[model samples]
Target: MALLALSKCYYLGNLDQKVFLNEIKEIIHFHQEHHNLTRLAYQSAWELLIYTLIGEKFYEQVIVIELHFVRETRRELEELSKCVDWKRKKVEREKETKEVIVLMRWLNSLEFFFRFCSFWNEEFVGLFGNVVQLFRASSGNHREIRGECIDFFREAAGNKIMKVEGLLKGGAIDAVLEEISQQSLNEDNKICCFSFFLELSERLQEEKEDEKEEAKRKVFDKMEEEGLDDCIIMFHHFLLEEELPFSYPDENLECYFMPL
Candidate 1:
């Protein structure tokens, strides 16, 4: 299922190299022990695609550093697993994860990391590309959170949900949205995703009159330090004069803030 989702990640979004390598390592190691090389290879390829997408998010220099780490660790972990014939060690490490996923805690570490990345750009976006989604999923115990965000909101907002007879055409998403959107999901995810949407919408609005006034103060202060306040005028201030833009309709998109 992860593999299937990952296969679509490339055209869908990108990830940072460090994040990609770490995530790919978890994915590869999980199924590496499988008896069928074919299945494992398929999963690996999908993970590689995801990694490459993530790699593209970074500059070449940063990616090179992370690639070295990924290669080194991949080799080291492979060697470590081989040197130990003890099934107990493998079981111990895997069991410690608490979840069925490989090195789940390590993956859990990525939550804060992706939130940090989001401050940069939404370009590296995908099903689980945003770490906050992972947090809402495990911490809140919402198994369908991914489905809610991806299957329902993101994809619907993206216009990706097609005419499926029961599942999508007339599905649980329809039901859930009716309830949740009416009064919000009342879950952590509801607060998080909805808050994100609200913030994004507000950001789309260029600085308000008060914000412009506050911004003028800061700019003028900086200009006093640099002696360039009069020399600097707000260029490309169209946002201040125009209405906030909205994401356009598509066959595969959902309106995350439609509740408004």
Candidate 2:
């Protein structure tokens, strides 16, 4: 209907289109009018607006519009996550499961949108916990959704604007370290976790000319203190399995593994 037309227009419009604001406002109004959009059809309509905004090229305008609904959208996503049975034992009605699937897909799109926009606000930090919970649950069976959730964390953790102390206090770093310590963790998952740490380390220490090694050393020390020696050993095994050279190209890696 009208929403569909609006979405098409916005998607086709250029970055500087003047009508974007009006369309954004109208979509927000529609969302507010139907607050509880549990029905799959209605949620699909709601997601059209999200998808449109995500695909838009004008980041400035998109940021403003996204922030407008970020809180409510996150709340709705949290509720949907709660409804999912992570163990896959509590089978939901087929229609309801389909609805949840669509909603989660919309959440995946939102995560992508947040990537280009700054999501370091207090609200986003709060939402991060729910996202992590969903990530843990999605790990059970929903592979694609789990990857999307991980990407959300990856983007947030790598965002230079994100407060390092706040992220640390939120237990994000600790959770990652713990995840890496798990023996059952796959190589790809380990790589993702390590990549986040590398990006985080780079951003956090980017300004200091000589403290990069010190920062990396602190991470290694924490990992060891947390009894992650096995994890490091596994990482070495991963490198060997990949047929990479025993020595890294970077000189700083000389002392990375130590005498363990």
Candidate 3:
């Protein structure tokens, strides 16, 4: 809790920048060395790191690169993912379940960062592949984790700072369409999937007119190759089965309904 409080204080400009940076460095080291910490404590430390990164001034500090923040966080998540045993019952594997929950928290934090923070560069590209891997690994169960992954993709797509090429290289299109095809998705996640696709389409449209057509063709071809037709059928069935209250604008709706 103290770590979270410190993050909040730093975000609100109540803490001196140098002091907070030094404290954050110490916390990062502590978190890395203290593998025995409770899951809740570890999660709080991650939240602190994420919150601090959201601050533009803090993000610009050399400490972000010096400490290898992206690499460390990615490695931590990858390690935790290996600990999850989906075949076992949640009660029997409580620790693994907690790890899954922590993964979800990490996803949510990254999504929030992508959405609100304008800072984007090559340093953050590796995390995109991490998100894709988590999405694929959590398939058939852990709907919450998958939903968080979709939300992350949605925000990353909409964030103008992120290039569409980065998303493509990360296999985001395949992940988004694959998630949309899952029957277990709840209404909210279904909406998020559509939003992700819409955002991707909008991002593609931002290219020069000549490049725009080629980009759209490539995405459409990829979508078709990925069984987009079946996804559309499933989505149509979903619309009939559930009375979703939220309405999509015509332009946004066209992305789905337009002839392939």
Which model scores highest in lDDT?
3
Candidate 3 per-residue lDDT, tens place, 1-260, comes to 67545534535744444556666667667767875556556656656656655646456444346566577668867987898765554456435466876787778778877886666667676788888888877775555676788889999998877788888887887899898787766767777888787787767666444474586567667768898987656655654686433344675564564322
lDDT of each: 0.37, 0.59, 0.70
Evaluated against the true structure, the overall lDDT of model 2 is 0.59
What are the per-residue Cα lDDT tens digits for candidate 2 across 19-129? Answer: 465655564566667754344444444455555555344643454355355566666677777777666633443444764576566666555556655434565565666
Clash totals for all candidate models: 12, 0, 0
| Among all candidates shown, the one with the greatest TM-score | 3
In candidate 3, stretches whose alpha carbon ends up further than 4 angstroms from where it belongs are: 4-19, 29-43, 52-64, 89-96, 209-260
Candidate 1: lDDT over CA atoms?
0.37
Selected candidate, larger lDDT, 1 vs 3? 3
* Ten-residue region with minimum lDDT total, candidate 3: 251-260
Checking candidate 3 for backbone clashes, the offending pairs are none
Candidate 3 lDDT at 136 equals 79
Error of 2 at 51 (Å): 5.8
Report the C-alpha displacement of residue 191, candidate 2, in angstroms: 1.9
